[model samples]
Target: MKRIIYYLTALVFACIHFVSCSDDEVEGTQALSVASFYPTIVMEGTEVTITGTAMGSVKEVVFPGGIAVSNVTCIDDRTLAVTAPAGVSEAESALVLRSENDEVASRQTIRKANPAFLSYQFADKEGAMTGSSMTINGKDLLLVEDVVFTLGDDVVSVNALEMTRKSNTAIKLVVPKDAPIGEGVQMAMSFKNNTSMTLPAIDIQKGSGGGSWVQKEVPVYSGEPVDAGSWSGSVQLAATLFADAKVDDVIRVYISDCGSNPQGSLKNGSTWVGLTDDLEYFNIGDDAANGYYERAITEEMLSQMQESGLIVAGQNYVIQKVSLFTAVWVEGGDEETTDPITPETIMLNDFEDHDGHNSSWDASWTDAEATEFPVDDNGNVYLRLAKPLDGWAINCNHQDIGTVANIENYVIKFDIKIEAGVTGASEAAMQFVLADNWLWVGAGLFPETTDGKWMTVSRNISDLSAELVGDLAIGKASNGLYGGVIPAGVCIDNLRLDPKK
Candidate 1:
């Protein structure tokens, strides 16, 4: 019995050696092979078959984890159909085939899910009207089957055209033609995966702030002479200064008149207009006890005066402090012009402040202050330069500040700040600019002198141009001679462009 056992063991060893040799000869190459894998493929309910070659007769094949395999049909000895497990991952799987001798295996890629319709649509503001072509930005949009879009929730009738997936992230679609223009209506988009996305509806108002930016309205009357009708009763009064203005332009306000003798008044009992806040009550026919005097108006006083009827139009007014005038004045010196009514008394502050400097001050080595564009409780702006600087030359050939237009009786106004206690003012004169056209070479005050106080400076644009519409460039030296810097450090502010009456 021992001899028989030894012989049987030797036979078993020989069989094993034969199998090993065969495997070594066919290293790395499976007798049967799976061609390729359908990566990223989605499976709904699709059948898959394995294809390869087998050396011996093939029997039944099994899938991974002992799942029942069906629809098995051998082509010859190798290629056959083995049922793929439904709802399994579309990835690598082991296939065991029972051959005539033993079982062999090769990996087959199984696709449990096939690419299907998700959802897609334009991402527009909710309540957006129809014909809105909004960008449909999303994911899983690659290789999309179809995209359905509609105005409302009902998807029965899709008004949207098929979306051509530009990439995995974006698609383009339009709001349906029949979309409503009111609220509560939404835009729905469906992707090939049967997934849907909706955008909130927006009201179809004309200007419902439908922009992506904040709105900013420029301040109109940044600084105009305090008017008699200063009290509009509302904190936000509708100002007339900036109804028509250009950017980077300065504006000014000057007090025109104080009560003249024989205090003028209509039966309305309105007091005369004054540059100052101090008021005097007098009998109808008598000169008020105090002679023509000076009275100052603090910001608080101005508010109080606004509340009283003393600030009505055409009232005889006086200057509390030496005051300035309105910014939109005529050309040339505000030299006392006849008060259209008096025709004798010169209206010192008649012209609006848009006018350029009233005079010029050359460094004759002799000059004075409060002469050209005078300032009281304020400083005057002077647009002077040493020489030609880069990107700073006076230009009036283009639109905006650089172009020349038909300007008639227009004025230019600007403000300046002087350091407190400064004594001497600068020789930097404001120009009645007329670039490319006949330049108004400091027609008014040259090197305009001031009291070294923060104030406003204005010039009549009409003095520089005959055209009713003309552009004004402020700072420029026509002579090309370099001038020394004016000791008075002045800051320019709020340049303006106003129409002249």
Candidate 2:
């Protein structure tokens, strides 16, 4: 009976040992399987919790871009934590996990995070103004799909055509005029195939203000005419205002032929009739004072009037009553300040009209040939210089400045673009000459290498004395002489004289 009891005990112990060994072998051979990961889409350095079976022995976690994840920790048999790696390419990639003897991977890709919001501002100013260009700077900006602005009840969406992708770090766009004005205006940017984030509120100021018009009529002519060799005319027209005028408020001068008995009322139908359709309005700019305005009746203005049949050249006409009209901004309205009108450019020749020749510019050549031609089907014109035997000269006469006794307050400016890959010349030079008694000369040399870009050349003649008027001449020179064989050509435009501001 004792022997049988001992044998039974030994058998029971063996069974217990066998069961323990089977359990250990099953645990050691368990196949790794990933169920899912929390927050699958994460930014760089974001901690992720991966839940699955057989994750206790996780030795490595590989993120997108084949980058090894850092700060990995295996919590237990079913949970693991890891920090997403940085420098991942912009795409969805598989998340890989490795153990001592086996590896497991999630079927779902780990997507790269959306672009992070930083800041934005106008390109030229500290704050964005209506119609101003704005730039947004941030990290991973290339992922951005669209940008929108919230203005009161209105939602302004930036058009793709208006937005310029400057680079991966910057985007440029124009601020819509209807953008809400006040503090805490919200802006949001969205990314392609990803979530969007809202930036902090921005302050928007009142971009425009209101004003009233006060008009005063003055004489027709300001000074006597002087002979400018080519043309002569008396400059005139000055008006006054009672109110403090804003920069955008313009003083309009209306004229009528004699015997019209025109009333100068702003609303009278007869007054509108008197201001004929041919010569309807003359916009005069504001002077230094808010109440002062002036419009010099230049020779060009006279020519325009004559062409419009409002007046006859070399014919005397009676002076009718002159009326002044001013358009003022209204408060709390949609009216915006008009862009300040640039002063009238004398001797302006953009080559857009008259076959690349203006009334004031006369083409003269010495050792080169020039032709006025349009660059494209758009009718954009330019003066093309080609096949230069030596060099060329073009003369422009500014009657208004030449006629003035003191011609010391003008600037001559023009644009030049040399063709790329121009060869056969050691150097090319440009020479400017003011050829009468008040002689002035200036020259600019082109570098041996050029990128075929347009450059503006300007010379101020403020200090030169004006005893007599002469022609303004421009020419190209090579090796101290006016002539050379040009393999590639050049384009010239926007030749004009501006009053020194």
Candidate 3:
């Protein structure tokens, strides 16, 4: 009986040992989750925050290759307010959470930001001008006092008689007129706390120094309507040559000079060639620093802008140079007499070279016949359609010659004024054609078929069938003189030949 009792007691002791060991193992195990911020949070930054958590105890918080956390205050049992001191490198930093017994959890991310200034943009009720004085408007400018503008260490100081607080984001100041032009143009605005920003380019003219527009008759070109006038390539017709805003506020057409690249800078689109396959929307060329539109097309393209074609087979083409108020169609060339396309043929070949083939339109004179394409004092001309059109199409043989490889897209940029009459119809507002090797390939694009609105249109170049790269054209479809019948008016302006990049 004594021996049996001893065996049972030993077994019980073994069970208790196992249980205690299991409990110790659980306590020693650790887990942690650390917060991550894509752009490292600066000392005083307040945009976004990500946190990392550990299942076990946390000991020290270390920043990878950066300044260690100085004053860490425990907000609660799980949160800590970590202070990132200044003077750390502007590189990525890893945050590590170490627990007791050497267990640790880490997160790799950008270093916490410092209070370094980035830039300042000065503008006011009137507008941002060169002579206008403005100050800092962002956060963490508390220690700012005297601001210094610099370029690559060149310092220029502006006297601030008053730093009026227009709001949390703006300050008013008085700038010296004698400030240097080129060097002082781009200033690095530094504050008393060492936090500074680079100022943006400012405009000098606050008001229109030029005179108002005056009615003056302009000579019409031989081919153009009596009301239409010719604008030579040499003239900087900022104040004189203008289409009716009602017909088209934004110009989608461009004129190029001889020996110039047909391709212009394209904004809001792709860059590389032969690789891009999608052409969702069109964009315009990059605008210059000045608000006025400059020469965007090559000289060669300009020479071909108004090419006349004789109808090879069909009825005589009624070619009239009337100012299009709204939507209208223009053909690039007459159809092939030998190859009459039928419904059995693919849609790509249906409209090939159909320039001014079938379209009709209306024209209105913004200023009476007293002046041809009215000119403002600054040589700026303003013409717009009295009403808007529902839809329109284009077919031009102008393609970007600089494009060499697999042509992926043909982009066009213009403004659409819906309120004037451009109404967004169903799936028929805008459309485009795509081709490969000059053979019928496909047709995929959205055509603008709305009334009373101004909008930008960009059709995919790959959508055209039968040709992938080479010559291209744009136009509309109608059943009138050349498949164009205008019920509503649509203005077109600022035409551009935008390359993907």
TM-score of each: 0.22, 0.31, 0.24
Ranking according to lDDT, highest score first: 2, 1, 3
Q: What is the Å distance of residue 332 in model 3 from its true position?
A: 38
Q: Residue 212 of model 2: what lDDT?
A: 17
Better of 1 and 2 by TM-score: 2
lDDT of 2 at 111: 72
Best by lDDT: 2
Q: Residues 459-483, candidate 1: write the lDDT tens digits.
A: 5655645553422232222311112
Against the unseen true structure, what C-alpha lDDT does each candidate score? 0.32, 0.44, 0.29
| Model 1 CA deviation exceeding 4 Å by range | 1-31, 37-40, 47-68, 72-85, 90-146, 149-161, 166-501
Clashing residue pairs, backbone N/CA/C < 3 A, model 2: 222-236, 390-483, 390-484, 391-483
Off by over 4 Å in 2: 1-341, 348-362, 367-372, 375-378, 396-405, 423-426, 435-450, 462-487
**Taking the tens digit of each residue's C-alpha lDDT, what string does model 2 give over 325-426?**
222323332222111112334434443222122422444345324544335322234565665434544444322222221234466565555677766433
Per TM-score, the best of the predicted structures is 2
Rank the candidate models, highest TM-score first.
2, 3, 1
Q: Give me the overall lDDT of model 1.
A: 0.32
For model 2, give the RMSD to the true fold: 33.2
Q: Is candidate 1 or candidate 3 better by lDDT?
A: 1
